[model samples]
Target: MFFIYSFTADTPPNICITGPYKTWRAVIPADTHSLSPVLYCSGCEDHVSVSADQPNSQMETDEPQSFFAAFCQLLFKSVRYICIYIIEFFTGPKQSLKGNHSDNKVNLVLLGMSGTGKSASGNTILGRRQFVSRTSSVPVTTECQVEETEINGTCVCVIDTPDIFDDEIESSVKNQHVTKCKQLLQSGPCVFLLVIQVSRFTDLERDILRKLEKAFGSKAKEQTVILFTRGEDLQCADMNLEDFLQDCNSDLKNIVDQCGRRCVVFENKTSHKHQVTKLMQKVDEMLNKQQNQ
Candidate 1:
């Protein structure tokens, strides 16, 4: 018999089921903003008893272990349904949560169409202009480029890919770009940052996501986040980020939803390091959330 809990971006959700079978304790942390208020379904016929952890001693029936098993089955089913419900209910088509964390670790894959600030974000993350920057419209990233930098004592492998979604470009060039991204992901866990301008979001952004799905498979969805360039422009001393996102453009909102509502806007043209630190903090939060869940 078992019970399960799931996590989503909306609610500070994470639950751990521990202890002996019938006496197992469900720890719902203070920040867990659960979607449903009810955990113990009162209608189940498994001779089960339930009570709020805070309100009373657990309401336990003198039911057999097998009786608890039936209730456990119901509980497991509820958790499974809720997990998918949260993602589908709120998660957008373009953004998604990063995948499970393991000992494999993760690298960063900076991807997007030309002029979306991929190279700039890479430089901001690595604390240097590791790749060429230009004003021309043509995709300068003729091939895949790989570089590794350390951030906060962690090895940050940054891989830059050419515009794979470029239709006018040569097919060979596109395929080479895709190959580089894959090779990098193969080395370890990868966080693909879809760099884009903060001033605007467009259909081209969604189109790029579809291209990524085709080239890298759905697995990439879990490991991707939208890095909004020119974010420092939007920062406010009084307004919170949640408000900013709520008031953002539909395209921006869509991208935010895609990356599991995770965002880190930055001012790439400036020489501030706080933006990179914020990015690291977001990644670390993601890891810690997965671990606690």
Candidate 2:
């Protein structure tokens, strides 16, 4: 006599049957071996059976298989990232994935009254005539313009603006010019070049610093550098920058003092590269000091 039964254990139970000319054997299916189902003889009255509450062995193994698959996937991702980093180290990235180098540039904003040589000074700093600069009864730079150049490996952005401090210019127009200048400031430290002609401080320029503060906030003075244009005027007068500043009007001296006494004399008519170099050195020093603070 034989009977079929299914067990959930890993191994089949051993059964012993003793009767007159009767014996029983156990068998397991090949296809359902993982389930560990067992067959027993019907004559075996005493034997262990699987309970309904017991879980199958096949179901238990599924969790391990899932975990192994997840582990393999994680290992593959790790290898891929390593390969990418190695490739980049060897061949370098095709482009800047984060941002461009222009974000690290320093902006040099030219601010002064009309006929103060702002446009000419901008051209001198850039070492090119990017702005229309010429002697005229009216403002030569009627709008704001931007140009870029490199000074001693440092990227420099020069911004030339119209005479926003002019009394004749409408307040709305002045505000618009100021707004445009602020927009072009972009992302970087800004240094304002308060251009003033040598020995030419007029009534219009007396309160120029106050107007600058009104346009760009009071902190503007902290980063301002008084740029005296037409160094030839000082040379013709047989005086150096120090002498000129010493004899300058009280209001002009006060403005320079308010700007931390940062000043540079530029002979825009001459091709003296050292002048630009010296100015850039001062700018670097200012930037370094700002960083330290």
Q: TM-scores across all candidates? A: 0.58, 0.65
lDDT of each: 0.63, 0.71
Query: Once model 2 is optimally superposed onto the true structure by TM-score, how far is the C-alpha of residue 216 displaced, in angstroms?
Result: 0.6
> What residue runs in model 1 are displaced by over 4 Å at the alpha carbon?
1-105, 170-172, 235-244, 288-293
Superpose all Cα atoms of candidate 1 onto the true structure and report the RMSD in Å to 1 decimal: 14.7
Tens-place lDDT per residue, model 2, 1-293, is 23233333343323233234434333322222232323233564422222112333222221233433233233323333333344344444343211232234789999998898999999999998889999898778878989999775667899999998889889999999999999988577899999999868898888998899999998888888889999999999899999999999999999989988899999999879998878876776677677668
| Candidate 2: 10-residue stretch with minimal lDDT | 50-59
User: Could you give candidate 1's per-residue lDDT for residues 150-199 as a string of tens digits?
Assistant: 66556778888777776677777777768766776545556778787766
Pairs with backbone N, CA or C atoms under 3 Å apart (clashes), candidate 2: none
Clashing pairs for model 1 are 94-258, 95-258, 95-259, 96-258, 96-259, 98-222, 99-222, 106-189
RMSD of each: 14.7, 19.0
